[model samples]
Target: MDGVTVIDHPLVQHKLTIMRKKETSTAGFRRLLREISMLLCYEVTRDLELTMETIETPLVEMQAPIVEGKKLVFASILRAGNGLLEGMLELVPSARVSHIGVYRDHETLQPVEYYFKAPEDIAERLIIIVDPMLATGNSSIAAVDKLKERGAHNIRFLCLLAAPEGIKNFQSVHPDVKIYTASIDSHLNELGYIVPGLGDAGDRMYGTK
Candidate 1:
């Protein structure tokens, strides 16, 4: 909990509840995810550095605050991470995008990376990794490892739901990166899935399963 921030806005909670229902249609789930992600994005980037820029209003000249430094990078962890990416991009249209393809080996529950593409100047900007569920934390950790190997120093992890086990594992490996989630669930089930979770986010998002 030391490095975690929970987005408990009423709208976020309400949307999450709808998403958690098994009867929810794929279209509904995707819509709520995008809506709630925008809210979560608001909280994750709350502390971004700001610099005032002088601008002339119709009435008079004024200084307005704008984000400082390079555009933030949203590094999505394969398929499911892309769900959060849409709404986040809607909020920060100028943010750069990174895609890291990593998947869990169902048997071993270990991560395997097959694809990765990111901006060349990743080291110069903030990277926020998005994944819907931080269940075992293996894939998330591997994704962060890939980013750090590419010289990313400042990083954060954002997810729709997190398990205590996954949170502990992630922090143990990458304590420097903070975590942002809409909810910290009860625990992970034996199959490496979050209990009472919204089911396979990638499947639910795309109507695959």
Candidate 2:
């Protein structure tokens, strides 16, 4: 809670409720996720630095403010993260995109890395890592581990829902990185799913299992 930001917007809350409903269809869940992700992106990037630059309007030349520094990288955490990526890209079309593929080992509940790709100058840019559900935080923590190993410094983690246990686990390992989310649910169940969560994000979004 200290370093985490809760979006708490009315629309975000409404969409989240719809998503949590077991009866919601795959198309409906994915659509709500996209809309919510866009709002989440808006809040996460709120403090980005801007610089004044000379610009010419149709009638006159003037100075205008524009975002400074290199384009941000939205580092999505595999298949589920891609859902959030869709909405975030809609907001920042010029931003760079990266993927870190990690999966949970069913027995151990540890993160397993399968793929990773990013810009060459990742260290010089602000990177926002996204995963829809921070159920265990293993994937998010491990994904950030890979990024730090590759020289990324400024990083932020965003998600649709977070469990208290997951937040504790993630912040314990990576305290410096900021976390943004729409809701902080009660707790994770025995099966590693967030209680009162929207269920398995990938499964719901893809109509799988």
Candidate 3:
């Protein structure tokens, strides 16, 4: 867990509990995810470098701090990752957006990419990959692998809930990328769902089967 940071803020914990409940409605679940995404954005960008700039207030001239470099890129992991994307954009409206669609191949238990689109200069921007669940880590790993192949060097992974096995597998393969999650749930079940996880995140958010 060296590179993993759990967002344990009181508000974050309370919101996550509401999200985990079996009875939460789709509208309510989506609202909570947006709010939580804003909160998580605060922590993840805490250490971003800033540079001082000359500026003028209404009455006088002064220097101000601004984030360094071009806007960041949020690489969402397909359908579910878009849930988190909605809120992160609230904080950084100018940041670039990328989408990666990957699904697990049941028989081989491996990740297969179906879609991928991103900024041409992906190698030059910091990328934050958002996905709701990190169950087996196969998809996350595969997504990161694809990004690295495209020349992305600085990358991070964020999720709402994760399992220890998933985290271990992710870190073992991508140790340089830090992981941020709200909760580390119990182990995954035989079918690959994280035990006690908030069900399928995409399904719950969309009220789909």
Candidate 4:
């Protein structure tokens, strides 16, 4: 994929395998998601611009590098995205947060937006949209649509799993935004679920059907 980056870190891959197992408990699934998300966050922000700042060393004064520009904005796509958001926050506690409430309509597989909130200076920050699964891509695309309407231009999308169909669909709509994921599964099933993917992430994490 031209605009996609697959996080193949060994720890991430190992944890994802356990999360995919049907017998894994909800607690286990949620724990692994949080743990893996930090690793994903590491790669996603690897290229962040940096600026040198004056700092005091044990023996002398020196210039140290720090992240440049405004703090990042992690735009979570409702409930499931919060799983990834939790760990990313642990890694980047200073970053800002944004919540975008969008869900896939079971019948139409379209996105329905219910809530949205973000920092007033969102347009000046790098927004990273978090979601567990990019199965049909409707919800992610819609969330981006909403963010762009608010003047967000520097944006990235992060997810635990993605389907080829979903990637194609998302790229078609937002080619400028890059995507980061733990894995790209085979395909989407008829019900808009990623094939060979960990089951509905929200259901697994929350112990719901």
Clashing pairs in 3: none
What TM-score does each of the candidates earn? 0.99, 0.98, 0.97, 0.99
In candidate 1, what are the lDDT values of residues 1-209, reduced to their tens digit?
79999989999999999999999999999999899889999999999999999999999999999899999999999899999999999999999999999999988999999999999999999999999999999999999999999999999999999999999999999999999999999998888999888899999999999
Cand. 4 Cα-lDDT: 0.96
| Residue runs of model 1 more than 4 Å from their true location after superposition | none
Task: Highest lDDT: give the candidate number.
Answer: 4
lDDT of candidate 3 over 101-188, digit per residue (tens) = 9987767767889999999999999999999999999999999999999999999999999999999999999999999999999898
Question: What C-alpha lDDT do the candidate models reach, one value each?
Answer: 0.95, 0.95, 0.93, 0.96
State the lDDT of candidate 4 residue by residue for 95-148, as single tens digits: 999999999998999999999999999999999999999999999999999999
Give the least accurate 10-residue stretch of model 1, judged by summed lDDT.
189-198
Q: Candidate 4: misplaced stretches above 4 Å?
A: none
A best-first ranking of the candidates according to their lDDT comes to 4, 1, 2, 3
Question: Candidate 2: worst 10 consecutive residues by lDDT?
Answer: 200-209
